[model samples]
Structures are given as C-alpha cells and as structure tokens.
Target: MGWPPASAAAAAAILCLGLLASAWAASAAAAAHGPRALAAVQPQPTTHGGLGPRSRHHRHAYAAMMYMGTPRDYEFYVAVRVMMRSLAKLGADADRVLIASADVPSDWVRAMREEDGMRVVIVENLRNPYEGNLGGMNRRFKLTLNKLYAWSLVDYERVVMIDSDNIFLHNTDELFQCGQFCAVFINPCYFHTGLFVLQPSMEVFKSMLHDLEIGRDNSDGADQGFLVGCFPDLLDKPLFHPPENGTKLNGTYRLPLGYQMDASYYYLKLHWHVPCGPNSVITFPSAPWFKPWYWWSWPILPLGLSWHKQRWDDLGYAAEIPVVLIELLMYIAIIAITRLARPQMTKLCYNRRPEKQGALVQGLIKLAAILAMVAAYTIPFFIIPCTVHPIIGWSLYLFGVLAFSSAVINAFLLPPLAVLTAWLGMVGMLFVMAYPWYHDGIARILVVVAYAFCSAPFLWASLVRVIDSLQTMLERDPYFPRLSEPAQETEFSKLF
Candidate 1:
C-alpha cells in the first residue's frame, strides 16, 4: 500500500515536471512568433519614402489624448501645457497640435488655443470599427483608434507623436530629419508607441483604416499593434544617429534609445552608472501605486519637481489651486452620489431581498469550483521532487491558493463590486502574463487558463449584478420612487 501511494506521487511529480518544462519551452517559443521576432528584424531602407536630410515640407510634433472627463482630464491638460513650456524653454517649440473628441469642454479648448498656442483638431466625424474597451486580453486598453487620426493632418510634412506622459529634457527637433516612419526599439524587437515619427498623408490614413477593417490584429490591442503591423520592417533600419557636425543625413534610421528612456532608469542611474545618459526625453509609464505627479512620488523622482514647477509657473498657483479644487469637488460629488445610490439601487433592483435571490449560494458555488480547479492544478506540482520545478512555479502555486481563497471568502461576504473587481483583477493578471516582458511559458498560461475557465461563471454573475445595480438607479428617481416601493425586475435579473 505504501509503495503504491509513493509510485502514484512519483508519477504525478513527473507529470508536473513535464508540464513545467513544456510551459517554459512554450513561452520561449512564443517569443519568436511575438514581439521578439519583430525586434529581431534588421534595419533596411524602404522604397516608399525618400531618405534624405531635408524636406521643404513643414514638420510638426503632435500630442493627443481622449479628453472624456474627470480627474485625469486636468492631469493631461496640465501635461500638455508643461510639455509645450518645456519645448519652448528648449527653443524646440514647433506648431503644437492636439487631437481631441467632440466632448472636450469648450473652455478647455479655448485655454489650449488662447493660452497654450495649441491647435485643437476635433475628431467629431472620425469613426473606427474597433473603438471601445475590447474586454478580452485587451481589457486594460481603450481603443486608441483616435491616435490614427494624426495621419489626416495633411498640412504637416511629418508628425512626431509624443505621448502626454513624456517629458522633454532638451531640444531634440533634429528628429524631423530621421525618416518617414521612425521609432526606437522598446520590446526585444517591437518599437514603443510613446514617441514616433510619421509622415502624414491621406494615403497612409486610408491604408491604416483598411487594415483595421480587414481585422488586422495588434499584439497589444492598441495603436502600437496596428503601427507595428503596418511597418513590419522597422528593426532592420539603421539606428537613428543625430545629425553630426553639419553632415547631411545618409539613410533611414531608428531613433537612438536616449530619445525615449524609461523614468525607472532614473533610479538605476542614482545607484550605478548606466549608458543612455542625460536622456533627451524621459517617459513615466503608468503604475497604480504612484506617478511622477503625486507629491509622495517625488522623493524617489525629484527631477519631476521641475516639471511640476513649470506647470505651476506657467499656469500660476492661484489658477492651478482653484482648478484642482473644482476637480476634487467633482470627484467627491460623484463618489457621494454613488454611495447614496447604491442602497437605493440594491433595494429597487433585487426586489429588496438580494440575499434570497440565490446570489450568495451561486457565488459560493462558483468560488468553491474555482478553488477546486486551482487545487487540482496545483496539487500535482507539490508532489514533484523538491528540486524539479523552478522557484517561479512554487511562487505561482502559492499565489493561486491565496487568490482562490480570498475570492471564496469575499464572494459571500462582500458586495458584487468586490466580485467584479476580483474578476477584472484576474483579467488584468492575464494581460500581464501575456505581456512579452513577463518572459514565462506554458505553465503560466495553463494556470491562468484553468483559473479563468473555472471562474467564468462567477465573473458573469458579478458583472450582471453590477450592471443591473447601476441600471436600476438610472431608470428610477431616487426620492420619487420611495423606499416602500421597489421597481419591477429587470430582464437581466431573470437571466442571472
């Protein structure tokens, strides 16, 4: 009996080791077919656009954002203002341009136009087939179809696109001389979307749109993907060396890495010497815990203090304080409304007996199923000999157990919002895993796949409840409906 159990354990261990080995190999294999493949392409000159030092056409650098509303709205507004100021300080201020949706406030438009010297182009008529939150692997992305509109600005001979997060340290206007399409390598083989040069034309615009219509997929589900797809031959081009000693440009070239250094390099440089020094433009990529703007984020990144000062000096503390105060008030009001409405919504939507509607039981069942699936997937790994698997496998095994347990506990106790957050969090995790930077293979994919399928029912239920809760408030007047009476059941409620 002892021998049989030991043999079974040993068999399970072998199976898990094989799975892990395959996963590692799969991830490595995926890299070749992915962005790494794109990066590996050697730079080669294209026949489509002329490669010369000078063009008589006007060159413009553009920065754009979808100014929908709320707290982030002011942040980008300030960013554009500061970027313009930084450019002017460096004597590199070309004609500043902004691409915005129709919904942007008239006052903000006037500010950018009158105060900042920015030409605001409204993307009112532009329509894209894939313009929304694509909720699968691209859940974190908002359709960046708007960025493609820059190609429609025909007056400029070339447009160097800069993301709002980028901070220019010096005048790098020489970039205009690089090429028709130019960007620096970011991923192993792919270029970053943050900073790039494009020659604007109706032909390019139509071509991009056509590619979209034909269902061309971007690896990241954003503009970067489409651009990479459009210019598949980016890597082989000569690295863009800045024009030196009044020499004329030789050939099409990639922007040097110094043009778009990650702000994280700031930390590394402080502790140790690194190349790509005195970056031309430093970009602060997104992170949830901190940003270069927040006061708390300053200690680690004092260089951003100057950028903040520039914003204040350009916009004035008096002017800045009131705008921030108004934004804060707006945020508070939105939160207050949501808090006051939640109980009213719950009371109305669920027939005032949310607990009795099988929500808790269903959630519990789903949680249990997820936990069981995770356990089944993980238990075999523990049976493997102590040294067979990588430390990453052990770490992920622990993470799955903890994540499943938390979901189970929260499923019954917390509101649907918690469940929805959990589901979205898991989705976000999958995106992180899928990102080329993660450098993992089949094991991670298998773990995610197992968890996602097992948890799908719970995710669906949670989403339905959250949507129904919001819809209930939208349909009825809070005061007029009266607490004594509940609204009729929704079609969604019946299905859920």
Candidate 2:
C-alpha cells in the first residue's frame, strides 16, 4: 500500500535526522580523545626490523609534517597517507615518519601508524616568527614552520622531509646517501622546500630557532623562505652524485631537478623528460586550490590521476566512503521530501505574508532570496570532502546543488530554468576546462576564457529573468487567501 503524505514525510524526516546523527557520531568518535591528552602522547619509535643489517646501524626516514590551521586539513591527511603508503609499496628500506601537530585527531594518528606503517611523532605546533608580517599566500604557511621539526628527529640519521602534495614515481632511497643538507633547485637560485634531505641534529634545530628569534631575512615567512635564508649558499654547492660504494656524503649539496619534478613541467612537454638524477617524485607547487588530491584537479592537472591511482592501490578511500554515502542519502531524502510536499509548503509559506508590506521590506526580502540562491550553489562546494574520486565528487556536488536550489525555487516560486542557469554555466565551464585534447596549459586556459566570454551574456539574461520573476511575485495577488477570508483550494493546490 502507498503511504500517506504526512507519514512519508515523517519517515523521511526521521531518516534525515538519523543520518545526521550518524555523521555527528562518527566525527565525535574520531575526536573522543581530548586534544591536550593526544598532544601529550609520546612519539612512537620504529621497531619494525625487517630491513636487513642496514636498519640496525644506519637509520634513515622519509618524513612529512601535518598541522591543522585550514579547512583542508583532512584532505592533506589523506594525501599524506597515500604518499606514505606509496613509499612503503616501493619497498624502500627506510622508515616512514609523520611529524603531526598534537591537535591532529588521535584516530588519524592511529590509522597512520597501525595501517600505513608510519611512525608518529606528535609535536606542538611551531610558532611562526613571521606571522604578523605575512600577507596573502604567506598567511597559509604560518604553521608550515613546523616542518623544522624534521631536524629534531634524532632517532634517524638521515631524514628526507617532503610535502604531502608529492607523488612517488619511484623509491627515493638514494636521497638518504646525500649530505647534511641537500635540496633540489627547481628554480635557478632558491631550492624548493617541497622535498629536501637533512641530517638530524638538535644543534642545527636550535640554531634555526635562534634565526627565527633574530628575525632572519625570510622572504615569504614560510619554511621555504626561512630555510632559504639559512642555507643561502646551497645553490652554489656541488651537485650530489650518489656513490656506487654507498658512502654517505657530508656538507650541503644541490640535488638534481629530477628528485623534485614540478608537475607543471609535464604540461609543457606531456612527458617526463627530466634528464638529471631520477624522476622519482612529482610535486604540486602550483595554486593551492588545485592540489592533486582535490577531485576537480584531475583532468586539468592530468598527473592528479597518478596520485589517485596510488591512493586506489595503497590507501583505499574506504574511510571516506561512508560519510559521502550518508551525505548522498541525506541529499536524496531532502530532494524527495521537498518535491512531495511542495504544494502544501508553498501555500503555508505564502499565507503568512502581510498583504501591504512596504517596498523596503519587499526589497530586503528579494535581496535575501537572491543571497539564499547564491549560498545554495557555493556552500555545498566547500562542504563536500575534497579527495573523493572525480566522478563521485562531481555527482555529490550536483546532487547537493540541486537539492538546495530546489528549495530556493519552491520557496520563491520562481522558474526552475532561470534559477538553474548558474549551475548549468558552472558545469559548462568545467567541461571546457577538462577537455583533454589541449596542446598545452595555455591552450586550455584560452578555451576556458573563450567559453566564459560566450556564456556571460546568457548568464546575465538569466539573472535579469530571475529578478523580473521576483518582481512579478511581489506585484501579483497572493496565492493563498488572507486569514479574514474563507480558505479555498486554488488550481495549484488542486493539481497537487
């Protein structure tokens, strides 16, 4: 038997609440351990002793750092996991270490150590001396000063500090054989800090801290700038050539560009033609918004697929799938309930409006409605988990945008097509940018610009239509009769 309207709505509402509760429960469970307590947890030492006698005497580690300051911390966590797992899969004879801030969830720490085979060193977030001086892009690097903690990892003789936005094309074990301080000069003068090798020494770490205290000449107020300030002579250092006899070198050395291949280079030639050293790692040092882990970055940054492939192979997205599924179900429930109850909802919403409201009041109401529509599109874009596969990510986004937009359309009594023009335009722009046949990045950017130019007129027309519809709604008689008059079923109610 078909269910009654009220009963179906009650059931859907209950389902929505239950899904929300589940999501909250999952988050609460992950954060069960208090941050202060988690911060006090000691660094776990590596005890996995399967890497032959070299593991006994010569300790080496591949280390990365994580701190929570931005909205995208979880995405970086996933990226770190995938990179560390890829390193493990390459059968590197070195330990994988994560220098994470104490505030990072204990669950994330546990997963990294127990599942990804990483040694966890929980440390306090390092204070950025250049914090007040930072502006624009430099502000995001405030907590990046924590990367200096790599030098405090005294347990390992040699540590390769890497950023999370790197994909391992091959094992970089040979990097451990380099000197006390080594880095690749992706630029002509300054070395890229995305990946660097350093020998652990408390003295060096202390000296770096002192430099920060003295307000050293840091160009960007980030670790990259501070390190560049500290090691100003690295660019002139002799290029590192790993000895066949396995003798470790001392002093600073410049690494070959292949050790840290910029992902942008591939777009130029569409191939890995790096001639120096080994083409071992690909780093995304481009726009922060277009990081490899973000789903929308794939077709635009084709190497992003390689990152996802490593993730699929080593660290599966199983941990992220449940939340995504729950959100999807909630969105579907919302869309269904709104569709089923639209007529009654519209009548109830319209009945309460005063017949003689002022023009200022009406204008404010119209402005609010417009703002609601704008939020419907944008707020969903930020809420979706960032690292899901492109297909799943885009699907969830479309569903979310539709679900939110539907409510706005029903509430405002506007034409659906006009309301959806922005969403359609966004999809069109994405298609323009994602076309795979572009000869280079320049061609792709040009095509996207052309598409935007062509679509702007239609988008402006749609906006005008939406505003006109709002004005018509304000001017026309109310859909429902006032409380003084006897209620009568209108044609809209009859159709429902």
Candidate 3:
C-alpha cells in the first residue's frame, strides 16, 4: 500500500517530537545537576547568564562562513546553506554567505547569489600533489589549506567555521564574546575537527595558515593536524555535555580515529574542565550529535538548539514549513516514480517477458533486503558505544562494516565471508592491544592495523554505497547486462 500523506505527516511529527523530547529529557536530566539559562551558540555554561537580555536588544551577530568543496552532490551544501540562512534570521546582521565549489552549476550560483547573497568561489586548477603518489590526498589537502589562508582576510571576528553539512539552530553572536586569540573544539573523545570556532586575528589565523602550508606534505592531511602541530597552544573548549551518564566530562587522548572526526558520543561530551567562564564562546563539531543524515553527520541539534533555542523557538511555524515542503517533495517523488513505472510494467505484461518479470521481482526483493539490512544496522549503531566500552565497541564496529560490505557485493545475502573477517579482525585487535606503547617490531604495525580495522567499516561503507547500488541495478537490468561496462550504465535508469 502507498504511504498515506496524513500518516506520514503524523509519523514525522511524532518522530520529531519524540526525538526532541528524548533529547530534552536527556538534557534536562543532565542539567538537573545545575540549571542553565538558555544561551546563544557560544561556548559558555548556561548558568553564567547565557546571553544577557540586554545584549539581545543590542548585540550584532558575527559574520560566519562555511563551504562545500567535496565531489559529492550539493545536498550537504544545501543543508549548510539552510543553516546559515537560519543564522541570519536570528535577530542579527545576515550578510555575506559564501558557497565555494569547483564547478557549480550556473543556475545554483544564480539562485544563491540573487536570493541569499552568497558568493560562489570555484577552484578549477586543483590536482593531486604527487603524480606518482598512491593513496595520498596531500596535494589537494595542501591546496585546500592555501585556500583557507585566502579566506582569513574576510575580516570576521570569532569565525565559526563549520562543515557544509552543518545546520545552525540559533544566533551566532554568542561565539564572538570569546575574547580568546583562537578557539579549537576537540570532540570530548577525540581531538579532531568536524567543526571549529576560530577567533580571527591576523596573527593567529595567519600562523595556522603557515602550519597548514608546512604540514601540507605530512601523511595526515587534516587541517586539524596542522593546527595541533604548529600552534602548540590551542583553546580546547568543552562544546558538548552527555549528562545521561557519569562521564562528567570527556577527555582528549589522541584522536581515536584518523583525521576522521567520528567519536563515541557519550565519550565526546564529557567535560574537559578547560578553564573558561560559563559564557565563553566556542565551536562544536558535526559529529557527537550524530545527526540522522544520510551523507555526512548532521550538526549537534541539541548543542545547536541549546545555543540558539530561543531564536529557533521564535522561528515558529516557519521551521515546520520547510520540513513539510521537504516531506511533500519526497511524497511527490514517490508518486511520480510509481506512476511512470506502471506504464513500463504494463508493457512487460503484454510482452510476457519472463526475464523482465524476474528482474522486476529481483529489484523489489533487493530493495526490501536493503531496507531490512539498514534497519538491522541501525540496531548496532544506537546500542553500541554507549552500551559497550568505546574502544571495544569500536573494534566490533570496525568488524561490522566489512561484514556488511561482503553482504552488499554478494547481492545482499548474508555471507560467511563476514563472520571470518570479524573473527580475524577481533584476533588481530587482541594482539595489537597486548603490545607496549612503543613496540619494537611488527607488533607496532599490528596495533596500527588493528586501529585501522576498527575504523575501516563506516569509512568504507559510506563511500561504497552508491557504487554498490549501481552494481546491483546493472545486474538486475537486462539492458545493462548487454552494455560493455555494467557500472557505467546508470544513464538508462528508468527506475528512480
């Protein structure tokens, strides 16, 4: 049966309300230790008189900028743009929104410029830094570093540099109150940069630029790596709180993952006891909140709202309107696909195409199986880490990804290959954990390999879904089978 609109609408409302309520209960329970006045998007404790009522009447919002430079489509960019626009509405100066890309469609550029006052910056001369290099993002990372240096001149104080996948839930003026030379947020668990709040000084920002230039060739291509290594001095701020558990404050050891910013949420929100007044301005990364987005992680909605909850509350029905629109668009897409495919289905019926019937059934079965797998995957995702020790759970998680991938390549069937891979990874992890901190021999390399195994699944699965989906689609389509390169035949896709 087709999903009913009213039902979908009700479900969305219930889901939203449940999530918000659950998150709020979680926050309120945590906050019971101490009460906090709702604050803007700054790094201050709420008990410190968040945003002075007087400042609300007189405060000027700082100009913040972010970009989407990835090869992925513009959905993440659009989400970030929406977030930036939300920032503008929060009783502050909403000027200078910039979206950068290498080859943005003119239509999109025109829409953003004419509508949102966003300038599109494009970098076309980008190339890999090493022609003979294998598995190195050094050149591109270096070029991006150079570009950040160029962006420093934009002259915005307390720049809240966020990923293009982030959303803003409040007035960002609170970030500027930070008088620090610079502010760097390490997810309570790992010192990494999915997001950062930078106090812009020609001196500080320029020094960071220099660091990026120097570390451009380092094996680690993270901008965070350059900042951590060169600056030596960093304003590590506590950007989140996980009050649900006794992890009073998460501490930063080395980044558990590579430059990648994913971390155990409960671990990431523990307080670092960094010295700062309750109302200090700061930055939060795109992880921790674990926004239920399909592409990159979503902004920490609670953090985003905690900082801008009032502005968001003020948004009223307006916020609901966009969500409703998105849902309606999805509904429209569903209807369109169903109607168009019906005609094709009718033709197949008249021709009595047995192969066509099998393909259609196979595609539907594959889709059903994929949905089931995704549901199963969600169980481990929510239950793990918070329940299991992060290091141990993360190891299991690393194992899970490879198992899932094997299933994908083998047409969604549960593969024996996955169980073997998991056992192998678990054994490898035990050996590595046994090593001394400064192991001498393959033992050290084994530790690194084990760590890599722990992170490999999510990293691999995120990147390979589209490729895997295309492979499945090609296999199911008789027309695609006749093509020379089955993977390249998505252009003939009749199934949306």
Candidate 4:
C-alpha cells in the first residue's frame, strides 16, 4: 500500500514536469517565428537617399563658428571632448568652420588636429573677448568684432555664426535654400544671437563692427544689442523669424548644445524667447516637473528607467542595479499604500457638512491651489536646507494656507478691489524681507516692515471682507444707510 501511494505521487510529478517542458518548447518556437514575422513586415531603407521626389532639402549652407574664447577654466576638458564627440557623430563633409576669440587650449588644439582630424580652423582674435561686462551693448560690440573676424576668414560665401554653446545636430546646409542674402537662425533670445547666416557684406559688417557700442536698456546681452538697433536700419536685409514650432524634423534634440561650455542657461533663453533663427532644441531639457517630454537629445539612461528620471546621466556616476531596483520597489510600495489609504481617508473626511459634488469641486480647487504653491515655491526651496528645515517649512506652509484662504474669501466678495490690495500686500511682504537698502536706518525700517507685513495680511483680509459686506448691504438694502430719502440722495450726489 505504501509503495502504491509513493509511485502514484512520483508519476504525477513527472507528468507535470513533462507538460511544463512542452509548454516551454512551444513558447520558444513562437518567439522564434515572431521576429521573422516582424522582419517581413518592416520596410528596408531605400538606396536613393533623402533626395527623393519629396526631398525636404532646399539648399546647401555652412556656419562660421567664431566662438574661440577660452573655455571656463574648470569646464574646458569635458566640454571640449563632448563637442569633439558630437562633431565626430555628425560625420565628415559637414560645412563647419571653428574660430577662436583667444589662445585655444593646448589639448583642444591637439584634438582639433589629431583626434578629430576633421577640418576645424582655430583663428586668434584682435582683442580680449572676455574683457568687460558683456551683458547688453558691450556684448553686442564684442559679437560684431567676433563675427567680422570670423566671416572675413570663412571661405564659404554665406554662413552662420554660432556661439560655442550652439552645437550641430544635423548638416544644416538646407538653411541656405531661401535664396535670400540674410540667413535666418533659431534665435536663442527674443531678439537674436550671433548664431545666424548672412551673405558676407562688407558694408553691413563694416558699419556694425565700427559703431557697435552700449545702448539704454543697457542692452548688453552681447552684440545682439547692436543687431536689434541695426535690423531696422538694414530693413532691406531679409530677416526671417522662424515659425513657433521651431525645428522639429531635423532630429535636432541630440545636437550638441555647446561645443565649449555647458549651455543649460542658453536653453532657457531659447525656451522663453523665440529668436529670429529656426533652431531646434537647447542645452537644457526645459519642461518643468509636471509634463512628460521626449527631448531626443539626452544622455543615455540606464535600462528600464523613465527618461526624465534618468536625466541624472550628467552626474557622470552610474547608479548600481540593486539601488535602482530598491528605489523602484519603494516607489511601487508607496503608490500601493497611497492608493489603498486614499479612499479610506476620503470616506472619513466625506459627508461632513457639504454635499459630495460641492465638496469634491472645492477640494479639487483647493488641491490645485496647494499644488501650484508647492510646485512654484516649496519644491525649489526644498533643494537647499535653509528654507527647507521643519520649522521654516511648517511656518511658510501654514502662512500660505492662511493667506490663500483669506485671498479666496476676499475674491468672492470685493473681487476687483480686493485682488489689487492682496497683490500689493504680497509684493510688500516679499520686499520687506528680501530687499536690501544697505543703511542702518533702512535696516531698522526693514525689520519693522517685516513685522508689520507678517501681521497685516490677515488683518487686511478681514477688514476688506467687512467693507465688502457693508457695501453689499448698502447696494441691496437702502434702509441700511437710509440713502433713499430725497434730501440725502441729493446731498450724496453733490458730495460725489
């Protein structure tokens, strides 16, 4: 009897194993067939290249890059190497000219000659490109010299002048297609940057280079200030502002943002202001925390990490697999717990005083307001600890809640007048602490002002509400002020 039961159990286990083996074999066969099926469906690349009946190429062009200023003392190595790599990837036959505003670094010079072995010219400049605060007019002046120097040497008849930060994504030869003398560029600023193409004109170049100087607006973003002033005078020079979408079709994201320095700041300029040129992508992936974006120009991410989450590639330190896995697991756990707890919490807080619909709407609005505040202020401050400590955080958070509530109530009543008062109150509060007049009496005044601001928001909110209520009563019910009497009405009109 014991033998019978044992034999039966062994036989059953063997049968199960065989079934599993068969299933595994079938799965493997299916996978083998799957890729072949996909291969049959996918199209092969055509040999004719992109110059087909529907070719987008308009004309051939080249850019003259005269940004030979010395790289920031610290960033020279990595930045220059990244530039080389970007250039190598763009391939040979790219119409490029590299010029410098100062003595080029020894290593960069070596790489330009040996490692790259590509055709990049390094020209020395007439003046110290780094001299003076090149903020507005001064910046424009330097740029004019820089461009004049580079363009005069450039063999290409028409070319673009780009900063070191602007790197190539593709052979932008097509920009020359419009047949216009002036080649438009993707303006990195609202006005323009030197990264543009123009048919080298002795007259235009001479005038700009000769008289380019400072202007009010103090306009020192570089010789761009000069461009702004000159564009109107040279109205006959063809100027093309790129469409709002900029350049999307060029596989432009991965373009090197800077051949010299990290150009994250350059990216912000591009994002906020559409320059006159048609450029694609910038050094920074600029979408804020909430949006999902695929800026194809990215440092490689570790496998399975979301692109945004993987952006720490610039840190240059790779995260371990186990650490990444543990973080993933922790995130999953947190999400699960949050989902499970939310309904329970909602039930507990539900049905208090308001109906479900009203409560939901109000709750959503409040949540949006809180989230906006958290995103705009809290998250940024949280990066550094001074403003992020428990005491400071709690105090500001509480203050925001109270102030937001007061503003909401005020809006519901005397909305027009109340909003302006509330805004002024906020500006006063912000400056009360942040502004610096740099004198003893001013310091004392600031302290007193801070104290007053801290106390006055709630008070002002309440007083505004009271005045609003009084005004409402005066409008809806004449008996409150007895203004309905003929004599009083006449007197009121006369006083008004």
Top-TM-score structure, candidate number? 2
lDDT of 2 by residue, 1-496 (tens): 1223544454456446534644563454243321323445443333211122232343899999998767567788888999888888888898888887767878888989889878877776767878876786554788998888888888788999999989888878888999999999998878999999999988898888788788888888889889998899998899999999998999999999998999888877656878877888889887888998888786777777777887888777775676676667767776776677676555533554444556886798689779968867875565566777776777778878888788678767888999899889888876776677777777777787888899899889988999898887666555555435677778775543
Ranking by TM-score: 2, 1, 3, 4
Could you tell me the lDDT of residue 95 within candidate 2? 87
lDDT by residue for model 1 over 197-291, one digit each (tens)?
Answer: 77778797878778877877666667777788877888888777656663435444577777887776555333222254336887775562245
Once fitted onto the true fold, the runs of candidate 3 whose alpha carbons sit more than 4 angstroms away are 1-71, 99-102, 119-147, 188-192, 199-219, 235-496
**Better candidate number, 1 or 2, judged by TM-score:** 2
Tell me the deviation in Å of residue 91 in model 4: 4.9
Query: Model 3 scores what on Cα lDDT?
Result: 0.38
What tens-digit string does per-residue lDDT give for candidate 3 at 123-217?
A: 33223333233346443343333334323433344444455434333354444443332333444423444444344445654565454445355
Whichever of 2 and 3 has more lDDT, that candidate is 2
- Stretches of candidate 4 off by over 4 Å are 1-88, 118-124, 127-145, 167-170, 178-190, 201-207, 212-218, 233-496
Instruction: Show pairs that collide, candidate 2.
Output: none
TM-score of each: 0.51, 0.81, 0.38, 0.34
Better of 1 and 4 by lDDT: 1
Q: In candidate 3, residue 95 scores what lDDT?
A: 39
